[model samples]
Target: MNIFKKNNNLFYLIYFFLYLTLITGFIFDENPAGGGKKDYLLLQVHLIETGFTNGVMHYLFDFFPNGTLQHSPIYYIIIYYLKSIFSPDIIRLIIIHIFLIIPFYFYKSLKLINIGNKYICILIPIIFFISPNFRSVALWSGREILSLLFLIISIFNFIKFQKNKNTKNIYLSFFFLILGSYISPEIGIISIVYFYKLIRLINLRFFFKLFFFNLILSLPFLYYIIFFYSDNEFNNPLLVNLYKNLSSFFSSICIVTIPFIIFKDIKKYFLFILENKKLIIFILFISFFILNSPYNYEFGGGVIYRLLNLYGFEKIIFIFGFLGFLNLIFLIKEKLYYNLFVIIIFILHTSLNLHFFQKYIDLTYLFYFIFLFDSKKINDYFNNSILVKLFLTYNLIYYIANISYRIY
Candidate 1:
């Protein structure tokens, strides 16, 4: 008895058309477009060819010693078998990474927020495709989407357990949280957020069991890290370049949060800014000190990093001043607490992935938008003049710009 079944058919038809459109694009793409996808493809193909046998994935230690072994063994093993049969196809990657997981995550997140309309739930994924970041990331054939699926599933189950006190959901959450982190530790930092609930639910004995099991699962990876660190960029005395990490983190945060200000009532946005002048100054000062600290990720150069190279720490403070100005909109006007997990996700994501985040911002930014709506508002406003034309118009323009933007 869903009220929006009529609209649901139209969206399904639209999605089917979009699916076909994306398939045509994929068909023409000869050089796999994502960052690190080709590398992962090569690794999987190599693993199978070179005696990656008998459940001993120790080849992870031999082949990807630069901490690439940090990727969960399951993904490579799965891909190895797939490539063995299918000859290293990109379509398999696309079906699992882009078409399957990303859209499902958006749907689940919408449902978690109590968005009930089937049509509205569907809108989240469609709108995601409009984003410039999505086109690039989906094309870039990486394991990030796989990690995102596990991350989202874990979050959902944890929150479900919180509400229902369901042990089954909690166990599933633990499994997924570990699996997701093993794939990409960046998104797995979400485990920290669940600590708030874990503290309330678990006794000391259960904690010991949880710790012991996860430790056993993680032991090989822990050993890999110790051996891997010796020859890596982090082997240098300075683990990360501080000024770079913070500024990059600040820039990425702005990308996800700035749109609310850019698209909304600017007068009120600045009024709140003007009202909170002191807080803004304080934030900039603090951001300045923070930017002086670690550059965490192994950076892949891009337009953002190039421009950042030209600016000084003073310039970074000035820019954060601008983002701080826009943030007034969230702090004063919107119910920012509703997105506490998302806000934390973005913060930790940027913090952890400062080096290579430019190529990967698509992973989490789309979810920020996915969780931005409620079912009622989505239904009411999806066809509104501003949405049907203006917003989508902007997103489509951005999408086109990214076509030639060099994903790989």
Candidate 2:
């Protein structure tokens, strides 16, 4: 008991130390790294407040025609209201407060699912904070982190509904999921995964009733997208977007799965590969086709591409991408349908984007791998002291590297 207490204290200390760094970074740095969309978001909020004085309907009508508004308006609308009540600095601090609570929410969700012990669950949020993107999004205001909070809440409610079969829990899950999607449309794709789970859990009558209820709630955002959403900014060919995004997406999966690799039994992985030779062969063929395709090395292929490019070995991204596919195969073999659907939906969602960045996938995939993927596997690895140390060290190094890259 004393040992657990001591370790728990240490974890709290480390969390506060990291938390302080985020606060300090936000305060001292004129332009915190990442959140390339910050300026545009703020501008949109300003425009909404100053120009759209008539009403929300006026903003919706003028949205696509404005051309300057790149994202969904929900976040901007929230910010606009907040600005009316508080100064800009206070609004930013409010966002940071929202950002800080995410770890606690993560801990709550983990505990709800019973993925790991208290100690392991505590460590999960620390791992979340270690991600460079987490800090970046926290220190700088953006929709991603706020959207993540709502999604985590949605996941929590969904887990509760699964356990208790409570109608209220499922309703709450749908509500938060829709709320998150409005904040960031990319997150909306996750609704498909949630819908799939709902289909199996509820009867047809209840399912249809629940579906229409959420659909009614979602109508405002649907109307916005139908009338105001524009893809004029993304002029690249659809095939080009797919090729680049797939390579980056798979590479991202490989990068975030490193901690799992570090502690997992390697022989088991190889054994699965050997037993599924046909599947292995199929993955190899697809990987090779992707590798052979003409792709621009200049724009995003994710961290693997950037790191390998430094050594003039960027082509190795394909190998990591191949490994990523194998990880998905493992998920399929384990019958983790919810997780598999989340990943598939994320890929499809990102593939349509104008550019792919490591920030888009790193923290998001890490969250899935830790909290949503194979729980027994996570427990086995997370319980190891060495795995915890190595994972933290790796992320700290990543954080430093990102800062240096941005500064230079």
Candidate 3:
């Protein structure tokens, strides 16, 4: 199991080289290569005008087409500061910032968990670089980047809580969770996990304190929506039509990864189950409850706005996806099962990716894989042999193609 016995150094060197290539590609495409040119342009303009003043909130509340509001102004303010220095290339720099944050956050999270091997972090950037769906966000200008940033921050705090159940750390986790919710309401689904952590205290005083803080934090957004949101939900028939099937088969596949992801971890998972059964079951129940809840599926009316509203839970799906893959990898590495069952299920999950989001999903899969792969046993197999070279080449090709697309 000496995964790093041969050429681990070379592997890491090339991995980071590819990561930089993707960063360059994303930075060069600042003019809107895809469908979000206008969004970036508007954000860049707004950043120039507003500085750090929270004017973007007023803008989104007043004129954003969907009447959807963002929760945090911190990222916008940061962008404003960057714009002041970069001037003409502010958009490009901002995107570079987003692209860079993935690796930065990835490194930080792993380091926090004591798994931050240079080689492991290197492999992660390589995997994420190959993910075309990540490129979609890497190229866009919106709150997805902000949501991801805050989500990673929250995860860092969660890991902190995992190690030390300090009240301050727990509150810090919840605070970032709330910030993430404001950044992209879709990511709010992670709040249930946050709530679970809070409720674990089970004391009435702590419960009231958490509840009151959440309420006070939400008040500004609630008031703004009630007083200023002018969009009429009842008037949109097309939205109504979409509401019914919002969580239809496609979303289910995306969120659940079907039978394989579900069974992948079930068959081989021993570490967490053996170590923390109660917490594991709690996660499972909450994950299922959120996915099957009525609000997750399309309702009968105001389909468009409501359809967008349904996205708030996707963050939960993302977290579960990470866990599911990690469980399978751990199972395989531990020799818990020497069968093809895990491979078969993952293939089935891959087969259903007709809409091409699997590549992006692979990012989380790879994240968990490399994080765990850095263990001493797995690192023993890291040979800088031909097989490793070929694997690294495959990842580099993905970066090359994406960079070529941006340049040509």
Candidate 4:
């Protein structure tokens, strides 16, 4: 009875931590404003005004077959409807982005895995929050995070359908995926993986029927692309830009791992790397030195292309990093090794992508809390040997110090 009660309490604590973290994140976003990448802020306001006054909201938000807008009309349309009712401030938009949508999807993902126990459940978002290069995604009131939230929610609902057997959740999941795809095509690709997972679980007849149905449902958005954006600014030149971006995405992951190259003694440092095949894949995916070469032209040109590519690579790093860390925790008997690897991965991943570093820094408190109560053998080692603690502490501090070098 005591064990069961303890388990229940842990579950409650996990949920409570999620709520607290999101509230803190929202509170921190008090002024929420950006100018360079978020010029869409003014564009959204213009669309709302055009809709209210000229009654041609669609045209104003449309592609215009020229170098007018880089994004799709769906996001603007949603804002237009929202502005129809309440005053649309950037803070409110940001609160909605970070607090409502992002955290909810994050909680749902953790809950789906059935690890809602306080210690394990909180690790999901806390890890992501402190991950490097995550600042831009967490704070920015843009289509990317919103679209990602929708995509993840769609996956959650689809997973929920397996147990509830509710047609509604599946339908809603499909709706969000279609909507998210219309907002961000990269999200569309990620959504396909969820759909595939769903198909693998359900019976065949239902799978094909719903699959083709959603595919058809999303086809209309292509009409806007075909008719409106065919001759737009994003043509062959944009295609070349995207190609260059693909190269940088590959290069960033490879180049960033170069620092560890000189540290050949990491074999003694990361037990997680030794035991997990998943960790091996992750290391390969994000280690920049693994992919970069002297003739790497992909790293030097096409800034916008590199920016887009970085989004996909960042997602890969986050998912794999989390997976790798979890596996390390289970296998490693040393607390120092786990803490050091976590710190190193966090620093290396974020240092190169300072623009999005907020995502990783937000979880610092959670990690510190975990480290305080760690049960690994390395904890005893640290307590018994002051020199070991000093050495590890110095390395961790150096990890943070080098992050400044990556900041351009």
**Evaluated with TM-score, which candidate comes out highest?**
2
RMSD of each: 5.2, 3.6, 11.0, 10.8
Best by lDDT: 2
Sliding window of 10 residues with minimal summed lDDT for model 4: 353-362
Q: Write the per-residue lDDT of candidate 3 for residues 1-408, one digit (tens) a residue.
A: 343334456656765686676567556663312324555665656544643354665545544424232224445555665666776455655664666666666656766655533355444555455544455556654555666667677777766776777777767766776786665443444555456555765577977887788678867755654565434342334233233222232232233222233332444345556776787667566555432323332332111223345776443443343354344444354533422343332333222211222232333433323332223433332322332344456545654654466568
- Note the Cα lDDT for every prediction shown: 0.54, 0.70, 0.48, 0.46
TM-score of 2: 0.85
Residue 187 local lDDT, model 4: 45
lDDT tens digits, residues 157-244, model 1? 8767767887788778778877876767665555555654477787878767766766776676667556753355433332253235
Of models 2 and 4, which has the larger TM-score?
A: 2
> Which of candidates 3 and 4 is the stronger one according to lDDT?
3
TM-scores, in order shown?
A: 0.74, 0.85, 0.54, 0.55
Q: Which pairs clash inside model 2?
A: none
**Considering TM-score, which of the candidate structures 1 and 2 is the better prediction for this target?**
2
Model 1 residue 15 CA deviation in Å: 2.3
**lDDT by residue for model 4 (1-408), tens:** 333245556545664664565456445642221221244445656545654464444454342345455566677666666667766555455534453455456555545534244333333443343233233234434555566566667767776876688988888888887877787653454444445456667788888878787878888877767766656644335434333233333333222222222233345445545666686676555543332212223333222223444664432333333333333343233555645544443333223321222222232222222222234332232223342334334434433443443442
- Looking at model 3, residue 50 earns an lDDT score of 48
Model 4, CA-based lDDT: 0.46
lDDT of candidate 2?
Answer: 0.70
Could you give the candidate ranking by lDDT, starting with the highest? 2, 1, 3, 4
